[model samples]
Every structure is written in structure tokens, then in C-alpha cells.
Target: MTLLSIAGGIVDDSALSSMASNASTRKTFIDSSITIGGPYNFHGLDLDWEFSSTTTDMSNLVFRSLSYPAEAMENNLDWITVMAFDIGAPTWKPNLTEAPAALYNPFSEVSGDSEISSWIRAGFPARKIVFGLPYYGYAWKLKDANNHGFLAPANGADITADGALGYTHIRNRIIGQGGAITAFNYTFASDYCYNGTTWVGYDDVKSILAKILYAKGKGLLGYFTWRVGLDDNWTLSKTV
Candidate 1:
């Protein structure tokens, strides 16, 4: 009933301890879907994965999580969510526009998923493995900008606000705004509106649904989001 969500940004042990201290009353949960690097201390609460790099092998990440099972037990945390969004679109980067050629479809990578599952089987119970699904897609600048070198733009072609609308909201807003929707073979899904200057990039309902179904097929415990606020009309919860 109570889920602790962990994410990126600086978190200290005192904060986690406070949550664990009042665990019975607060029902605090850690969402670790976007954690990058940490064994961060939150009242002894184990750090969870945040947005990881494409280069991070899934097997290694699961091993890292398994390494802290004792600490998790001490903190009364029996569940661990295996952040798996990066597995879908390997090239997807929030701040970057163009994806590197090295990035490939994560679904096709057997070693990664197997390693993650193996780690879970060895370390935590099956019910503790919550998989992550993304509600947004990466957008790349067709042209170079600021010489950032493969850094993609943040607010591409989606509606509502730059990086504000969720996948569902983007679809609805596009339909409402009378914009054309198109799916690209390389990108999977996209929406564009002519603002008289440039085109943007974003994911559509099809892409989000694909991820959801994929998570279900993978026998994951549940699906989680990066942030509920980024969802349009609070659709993330509804989707879950």
C-alpha cells in the first residue's frame, strides 16, 4: 500500500532515516527509477537507480542493488524497483537531441534483461521488482546547436509546456491543437507543429502503450514514472 519512490538529486541519510523512523505512520516509499549513482542514505534506506546511461549494463546494475540487500533489510525495505526505461530506447537522453549510433533497441538486448532478472531472482523476491516505463521521448536537433556535440534539445515538438506534457497529454494536445501526428521508422513515434521556425520531437500514445505492454510481458511487478507532475491531467497514475 505504501511505496517509497527514489530519484536523482542530492538526498541525505537524515531524510531517509526520518522516513523510516515514522514508517508506520508516514507510509513513505522510495522511487528509484531515475537514480544515476548512489547508495545514498535516507535513514539507512538503500539508494535506487535514477536515469542511467545507455552504457550501463543491466547485469551490473542489478548486482549493485543486490550488494545492499542487507542494508535494505535493516531499513525494512523489502522491495526494489529495477529502473528499466533506458532499456527501451537506448539512445534516449533527456538533455541531448541526437542519439549515438552505439545506442540500440534495448528490447533486443537479451543479456541486459537477463542480467536484471537474474539479479532480482538472486537478491529480491519477484514481487519486489518494479519495472519503469517512460512517458516521454528524446528529441534531437536536426542541426547542430551551441557545439554541444550530440546534446539533444529538451523541449521538442510536444505540447502543453516544454517537458511538461506526458505522452498522453501530448497526443491529446496535438489533436486539440490541430497538429499533424506522424510516426518515424527510426524514432518510433513523433508529433510536430509548425511554429514558423523549427520542428520538435516527442513520443505519442502508441509509444507509451508499447512500453506499458512490454513491461507487462517482462513479468515486472509494476510500472512507475519519472515524476507524476510531468503527466498531463494526472494520466500517469491512471495508466498505472
Candidate 2:
């Protein structure tokens, strides 16, 4: 099905707020969208309203009152896609290295598993949830070559992709370059490799399969990747 994705910038929040607050405006906006998309044969629309700070803004968007918010989601939508990646990165916290999309974090509740559990507790059904995997990773410049591991001391974000690297680039420039030691952590369900002072954390075939198994075991509907083009020769996509 063709889905029209509507991405709004920070400046558009006020317009969304205005539309949500007024039923007439909301209908006009949605009707106009449908009219425009009819010729394109679009099946659905996806709204990516980046931020909704207030509860009222959220309630307005869902056409529900604060008391019955979960009910609104259950009735108004087919399923929810959870972005289980981008949990941490050197750009956000440069003191130490981190997993960009860790499945489990033993030390804390900041993980994909934890986030899924939170959604379940928030009244979203497991069968209606879809897990997300990343086809990209972050690169960190290690302070010491020997200290290349999760939470290891790091100089800062590496030069590649401004601390981010697609799977294709990671596989080609680093892993394919030879001598890059690749390691997978079963505990976190993540993959990382280091070549001298350059350390890259990303998901590989093993990690991707592990996450798929986890999603299946959890009774999730399915899984999706952030972008298909970033895959290393469709390796990650084929695995899923």
C-alpha cells in the first residue's frame, strides 16, 4: 500500500495545534489531503508530528479526552510501530561508548526490551506492536585501541557520517578493509568492531536475527528497518 508520510517541522506545531483544537479545521485539512491523494491511489496517511509537549495537544490529535487516551489508540489505529533504535550515541553522550540500538541493557532500563515493556504497561497490545531495527550505526574514536568495548572510554564521535555510518559503509570501509575485529554481544544483542582507534557499533546479521527472534518470542506483529537502502547488499533485509 502507498502511504503518504507527512513530516512536520517545529514551526508546524502551532498549525497542528490549531487544527486539532478545531473540529472544522481538522476535517478540512484531512479532506483536502484525501482529495490530493485520491489521484495518486494512496491507501493511507502517516503523520510524523515530531513533538507534542502538552497532554491537550496529544488528546486533540487522537480525538480523545485525557481519561480515555488508550481507548482512542485501540480504536483509531491498526497498530503501532516502536522505534527501538537510537537509544544512545556518542553525539548525545560522548564520555563513553554506547550501543546505538541495544536490545537489553543489564545495568539500566534504557533498552528496547524496557521500552516495549513500558508500552505494554501503557495499554498497547503486543500483537499490535511492530519492532524496529536499524540499518545504521554510530562511530566513535576510541581513546585507546585496547579499550574498545561497550562503555569504553572514547575520544568522541568519529569522522565517518559525523559519528553515524550506514551498514554498507561500515561493512565496506571497516569490516571489509581487513583486520577489523568483529564481536557480537549476546547479552545486549548488538555488534561492534574496532580497527585501531576507530570503533563502530551497529547491528549485523547475527544481531538482527537475535532481535527478530526476540520480537517473535514477545508476540509482536513483525519488525521493520529504518531504511532499506542502508543494508549491506541487502544482507540485513534478507536476514529479516
Model 1 gets an lDDT of 0.42
RMSD of 2: 2.5
For candidate 2, lDDT tens digit of each residue in 1-240? 567767543357887788878789989989988988888999878676766667888777874544435556877887777788888788786768888899999977898999888877878788988898999999999999999989999988996545989999999989998999999988888999999999999999988999999999999999878789999888999899
In candidate 1, what residue range of length 10 has the lowest lDDT sum?
Answer: 98-107
Query: Stretches of candidate 2 above 4 Å error?
Result: 8-21, 63-68
Model 1 error, position 130 (Å)? 0.3
Which consecutive 10 residues in model 2 have the weakest lDDT in total? 63-72
Candidate number achieving the greatest lDDT relative to the actual structure: 2
Tell me the number of clashing residue pairs for each predicted model: 25, 0
Per-residue lDDT of model 1, residues 53-104, tens digit only:
3222222333234244433442455555554433322133434443211112
